[model samples]
Target: MSFQKLILRLAWSVLIGGSLLAGSTQAQQLPAARDTSFTVRSAYLKEKKNRPSISIAQPALPPTVQASYNLTYCTLGARNLQLDIFYPKAKRKKGYPAVLFIHGGGWRSGDRSNHLPMAQQLAAKGYVTVTAEYRLSTEALYPAAVYDLKAAIRWLRANAKHYPIDTTKIAVWGFSAGGHLAALVGTTNGDKQLEGSDCNTSHSSSLQAIVDVDGTLAFLHPESSDYQVSERPTASKYWFGASQTEKPELWQQAAGLNHVTSQTPPIVFINSSIDRMHAGREDMIQKLDAYHIYHETHTFPDTPHTFPLFNPWFEPTLNYTADFLDKVFKAKRWAAKLGLSLLGDSEDYTCKS
Candidate 1:
């Protein structure tokens, strides 16, 4: 094994013995060369001999995740919003369930590449994952990012046949700023006002599931300002164009919690127990309850705001995510066939589509 691989393996072995890490998690083992993977290995990769892979399922290792980057999904004015698509090369009888990932940089700044590892990990688990770029505070403000996301979803659905994604099985996943957008997209289904007339306008922007990691749900709430930052243009200020005091209505509109209704999709919240990082979450949970929406929350106790971006925490974070998606997707299939609502309410989302 390569020296790096040896160190990682040993480190994992010790970590596993501590029972703090998921024992089933394994990375690709570098071959003294390469085999089993159908694609040609680069000289550098082939020399490693063993590539490390990890799996939460029965597979010995992660499936080969193929990444296609910088595919333009939509263009608003001069800005060309793009996405990086990641999926396993393993063919299936039908299309794979897909998830659109949004990155977190307080919404002021963040590139989609930050979530490439996440896209690959999700793709390895038999899902088509797309990490997309939307307008930032540097480019536009408020709903522009949300509109871009909705456009991307529409674009994905319009090209679903070519990409082989199950149009009926789409979800949105995001972290922090992306989390808020994902939640907004999930809750605002059928709202034409937010669904900008971008590419693939005919396709629906509705989502079947949402994964929010430490995202804000409402700017109107007092708890929303829990995080104090020194960035010249704070995320909220830049995104909203002014303080909530100056434009309360616009701030409320930008917040996802203000839009949650019975039509919202099933949502799973992965967060740090720090509470404020997921400001307005409990309030939204209460709203979801009142609306009879299906939702779940997984809080990582005593962790930093960057829990989802790093290891130890990342494994369990993803494990919960994969498991939640699997459960929701399976139930969604049955809910559609039965013509029943997955949220245990009268709203038949599957049938609506």
Candidate 2:
């Protein structure tokens, strides 16, 4: 093994005992260079020991949904980031609301394809759904992924006419690390510093709603598990390129909880039983409550961290997400028609549940 692989193996050993290598033979088969690339298959293998009968969700599109693959949204230096868009074939008179899905891999590993199944399901439910690729920690650290996601949002808006999307009703949905980015994007609308200087600058990167799946809102919160294994390099450390103590400002800047304001959009959080996975959630919700911003929280008891990719929790996950998006986006549409703002004490125009 390479020195890097050896170190990673040692870190895994320290984190989960020697069982890390013994748990899944498939994990050992992956290329050492790409071992950190988290995928649905790898997640299944990791969770199988806990839920022996757990099944993986397969990618299948409904007949009503048409998908376009590998559409390049932005080109950074020599790298071209691409996205997959799924939309209903039957066009809506007012255009469909758009949702951009970001996959979780602890900021280093997940791919856009991780959420393709969810994208197709939501597309079938009358929304333009997109799965986007962003810079991983291995490629670029910290705000690069954030910048790429915001750029993707801008691309969706710039191309709204072609895809039957309502430019005014775009939301971001993310899993784990991606969920962190999604929530951050929702809270930091019009943030010049987080917004990159490439691709679709003419369009705004603001989001109407946010769906965070098992993502932490604050990295330094007491409830966070980020630095629990002090000896090993945590994913946040890798992505931030520094320890929390070494660079507290960067950590706070990336935290969704630190950015929440009254202008922040409606948000829904779907969580697993793991408390550390959704750390800083309750505190952020407290802020939302103080502002009276619409938000919902749902927890799946006794489920694996990656519950949305598995069978039993997959359908419910989809239901909660779709229901939340429908309520929030529909309310926005209603408010637009009545020329009333949904922000502030407009509780009557805001969505519940």
Candidate 3:
């Protein structure tokens, strides 16, 4: 039972058995309900000796804080959806701005530990970072994963005092399928009632901004007139339900771009040129422009999807993310050197309000 195999199994199960929409209603879009018990577990994953171990030589002191453990916040079936939070432990009066990260495995397979290195690095650079696991595409469909992550945000807000997080300064960052969820969370802020059952506080789970890396924003491609369907039959069948022609409106509802509003938060979309999701990225940027939303787009000249995470530009990309978040938190127009360490790269970035 290696880690990869375990995650694959979980993914398979979720996509196969759990992704039944609320009901096969005749409506254009299936009405979604709050899924409170969205629990994820590491027991679904085993230690992989061959793969890279999630070990980072974090400095052992303040201003470089680190915390690693599973927090049982949401539950699904017998397993509790666990989240890993990492932050720079500072002696300052208030905690740092929190960044919630979601990993990408095509809404199917991925683990919280997969993003541990990024979490640790961000934490070391003085940001409260969290990587969480939500029910995958197998167990639930489009809105389920979306709802679970929103629940995680609500859980963080509810336990802000316990974690000493600054609720007002929260941003979401995700890749691939996780990127889709992140973008949805950013744009769909008006729909807050889906906070699920774990809410007992007034803190809102709405994100201040979003960072989407190679996620599908536009399900309906502009370049393709044929509407060549997705290869993942289960993904298409479960998300859109039946034929695209039979339910064009439902299919549109599943598309993230259709939901974008002027109220959408500031966004930073990054992607690789060769990725299949590139067209969707461009479409999202165009839509953002049409809505007058503040956004930044970065394309990794000649790389593939998720390459920015564990390879050559790892430090650079993470640094850019930290810097990007810094800008978003300063959206209120600050008047100080809200500078970033830039992963120790000798880059000087000092801005004022």
Provide the overall lDDT of each model, using Cα atoms, as 2-decimal numbers: 0.71, 0.83, 0.63
TM-score of model number 3: 0.73
- The clash tally of candidate 1 reads 18
Which portions of model 1 miss their true places by more than 4 Å?
A: 1-63, 226-233, 332-353
**Per-residue lDDT of candidate 2, residues 249-331 (tens digit):** 99989999999887888899999999998889989989997877778899998988899999988889999999988877776
Candidate 3, position 171, lDDT? 82
- For each candidate, how many residue pairs have backbone atoms clashing (under 3 Å)? 18, 0, 12
The number of clashing residue pairs in model 3 is 12
Q: How close is candidate 1 to the true structure, as a TM-score?
A: 0.75
What lDDT tens digits, residue by residue, belong to model 3 across residues 1-353? 67877776566555444455332222213323333222122311221222243222222334467586888767654546778887766644666778888987656566666667777777777777889887664455556666678778877788877775777768888877677778877677757543444433355778877888777775556642215753334445555334466566655665667677766777887776755664466676677767656677777776545554545556666877877777766543421334322212212222221
Tens digits of lDDT, candidate 1, 14-124: 533332111111211110111122111231244234322322122222558777788989865445678989777877767888999998777665667666777788888
**Model 3: residues with Cα > 4 Å off, grouped in runs:** 1-18, 21-63, 192-202, 223-226, 230-234, 238-243, 331-353
TM-score of each: 0.75, 0.86, 0.73
Better of 2 and 3 by TM-score: 2
